[model samples]
Target: MRYRSSDEDSARWDGFPFREGDIIISTRSKSGTTWMQMICALLVFRSPDLPASLSELSPWVDWLIVPRDEVLARLEAQPHRRFIKTHTPLDGIPLDPRATYVVVARHPLDMAVSLFHHVDNLNRERMAELLGGPAPAAPSAPPRSIHDSLVTWINREVAPAEAMDSLPGVMWHLTDAWQRRHEPNVVLIHYADLVDDLNGEMRSLAAKLGIDVPEEQWPLLVDAAGFAQMRARAAQLAPDPVGILKDRNAFFHRGGSGAGRELLTDEEFTQYEKRAAQLAPNDLLAWLHR
Candidate 1:
């Protein structure tokens, strides 16, 4: 996503303005944002009978394409318990005492790769068509694969951070939330753990949310929100003109863990590791390694 200056005219957010006891779903993109949204829905609603599609249930709060005020208005309009989504780091949010924030982390390697594919689907032409707004100019006719776009964005996004010997803003994002993981009102979940142990993570999530559904219902909730199942449902269930889908049914992409490393080069890997070690805390990097 392009980072427009915070001065851009619009509600961009007058501060998170969180209502008391509302749940806020926040994370960097592709770091299990949708997955955590689903988990929170299950916990809050306490049933598999999800009333609306994912968008209605949990709306994006900081989508630059939309006016920030419009995003907040949509979230505020929701009658159900609010669970708004954001990719901004915690420093970007309202951080009010009334909200419960859940931050989900994916291995940077996997996150980078997943983000690459995600950008590919929003190619300039596709973005204009899907977003109904001006699309970025296309690159000079090279056959740009998703990986290329992902890497380019990372490079462009990282230059400032690299110049400053920082891990780039995205790494700072994960570290900030990781540092706050122990707060009673904040929950930190590992995407790999969710992939490896869905049931256990769901239970842990429920416990954090102060929910306690019957034990037998756990499997049913997990199955209902399974990647394949959710993707299948989303084809029809998602709002019209679904944003950034390569195909209607392929939105979930691959849900496996550690995919980012497989696509990374030795050099990129070395740089990634060096930057991560320098910018992110040792314990956080160690957690991702685990």
Candidate 2:
């Protein structure tokens, strides 16, 4: 399906509907969207009964797959917990005081690497089949290179998804939210912490929502949702999972940290840091550096 960009100003998000008890995981693409989804699912149901891909259970509300009205209507009609996925920044979303919003933070460098892997395995033929027929020309013109695509979208001009080479755009997206992390309802968790301390973060995530996961069950939940475990379980879970890209193996692609310093060049790091200094809050930048 071709995704149409909303000509409507993100400012009009006030008109977008949100409901009480909704748990919205809003973040830039590939920035731990699935990780937080899994965390939240465990918190809400206390059992990993919601399939492998959380997106199967809770779809991306803003994706072109479903119209906004249908999304709003679905939220309003649903009786069970509604945990929606979104790649839009916070301001673009209608704020619901009653909803629990989690915005996971990943180092821009790591996100870029993850996205690079994302493109490698996309298997356009498979995606074309998934989308039905030939792939649509990227909404914007085809990007000359990945970096060019990043330039196009930051400007919101037009660029092919392939051209969206995000050498530093990933940094821009992260820094933007790092600046906004102070918002009262937005909870920020670092990919590093989430990866390094999965058990701790899982427990912490549960506590943040006032959910008590019995200590013994933590092992069961953690084992079931671990990266390799989840990847192995993907086909069985079926449909789609949040964070798991269009392809199942894509989700488990190189989940690593400290990539910014290791993989990015001094030139690239400079570009990333400069953008952060200009747009990211000083405090958030400090957190990233740490």
Candidate 3:
């Protein structure tokens, strides 16, 4: 399926060259996309100090702001094992056996909370300029409170492919990946697991990706992938190559989870669980929310 938004078009994957051992970090916004990219970079390079910025090292291919030809050329010029990033789901992009698809799943509420801040952190005027459109006007009305926004986001109904960040959209992206979890080239990593055990997760992912890191360098690579560390280096790590983020450091706001669930009443939480059940299978929801 072709997935296109105002800012991205999955159809751009057409005629793209896929090299052996290419890694595609397919994830929804604020769902640990950059984190996985960092992990892949660390594993691929066997060092914490990358050759370039994270955004340059791993470009978002589907993003419309970057010219398709330029992005392709950049990827082509890279001599290292390419690890591309994308918000499009597994079903939306072509599945190449030679490439590994790493999909990160986060708790819906936590993802929603992070996304709320992410949208607020965006520089709309800069984005509009990058896309060759006129700058967007400042908001006339006050923005919705995070609590109110979370409630609305949970209840709003939309097709999964159409709104990949909505409740349904989150489920859609994960559901497709969950089904393909057993495939050799598809790997599923949970946000909570990474938070709970960064060291172990990084080691496990390295093993899965067939990367053999020397024992002496494990500590440095793992530390570099930590939330605090990433936030500290936000200028280099945050994915804002074109000055799209208002505050690059703000992009790493609240690396932990539960903020979204805290904003809801008991009834509201129950309602969210029920809505999630309707959208995704029982086992998938269990793993996702766990």
Candidate 4:
């Protein structure tokens, strides 16, 4: 399945060279893509002091703004274990047995809320200029409130590959990974778990990636992965290699959960649950909504 969007193209991964022990952070937008990249960086380097910016360390492989050849060259030049980032689903890209695929799942409602803010932060004019496309026209009406936008997002129907940020699209990405969860190279990590227990999650991720950190450095590494810590260093940590964001610090917007849930009525919430059930299996839904 090839995913083609204005900003990305999954076809770019067709000839990607995957080395042994390569880590691919497969996730949807606003679903811990940067967070997992940070975790992998911390674990791979075994230190909070990364050699380069987080975006430079783990480039988004499928993004159209960055030349595919350039992204490949950067990865090839890296000496350390490579951890690449992608918003494409599992089926969209080639699966190499030697490489580990880490899928990060966040609550759909929370993800939707984060995405709402994310869209606002993006500099569409800059993005258009980078992609060599016409500048987007100004909106005729006022932008929808988070509550209204999310309600529409939940009810909107879109083909998974066509709109990876929609409700169906989110489920499509996760369901594909959930089925492969038993595979040795596939690992599933929840955003809520990371938020609830950053240290434990970081340790578990390090163990899974076969990177051993010295006992003395555990506190430093885990603290570096914290939301507040990442926000404080937003200039380097936010995924803004180019000037696509109005404010890099805004990219690290409230990393907490339950904001989406708070905006809905009980009936609306139940409707969302029902819609999710239709799109994903019971076990996957349980894990996602939990």
TM-score of each: 0.83, 0.75, 0.98, 0.99
lDDT by residue (tens digit), candidate 1, 118-222: 655553555465446666675689767756654554455454222221236667777778888888888888888988888889988777777778877777888
Report residue 140 deviation for candidate 3 (angstroms): 3.7
Q: Mark the regions of model 1 whose C-alpha exceeds 4 Å error after superposition.
A: 1-11, 67-70, 123-135, 144-167, 236-246, 265-268
lDDT of 3: 0.94
For candidate 3, lDDT tens digit of each residue in 1-290? 99988899999998879999999999999999999999899999998889999999999999999999999999999999999999999998999999999999999999999999999999898899899998888789998999999999999999987888999999999999999999999999999999999999999988888999999999999999999999999999999999999999999998898888899999999999999999999999988887
What's the lDDT for residue 11 in model 2?
33
Residue 191 shift from truth in candidate 1, angstroms: 0.5
Q: Candidate 3 deviates by what RMSD?
A: 0.8
Please, what is the whole-model Cα lDDT of each candidate in the order they appear? 0.68, 0.62, 0.94, 0.94
Question: Stretches of candidate 4 above 4 Å error?
Answer: none
**Pairing residues by index, what is the TM-score of model 4?**
0.99
TM-score of 3: 0.98
Residue pairs in candidate 1 whose N, alpha carbon or C atoms collide under 3 angstroms: 16-94, 109-260, 110-260
lDDT of 2: 0.62
Q: Which pairs clash in the backbone of model 3?
A: none
In model 3, which range of ten residues has the least summed lDDT?
130-139
Model 4 lDDT per residue over 246-290, tens place: 999999999988989999999999989989999999999988888
Residues 1-290, candidate 2: write the lDDT tens digits: 12224211233234656666778886666678876777677767778766434655566766643455665675676676777777666655666788777878777656765666666555455445544557545546543555543333233322222222243434444555566667766677888887788888888767766677878788888876677766676564422432324666555776668654675457766766776566456777788767
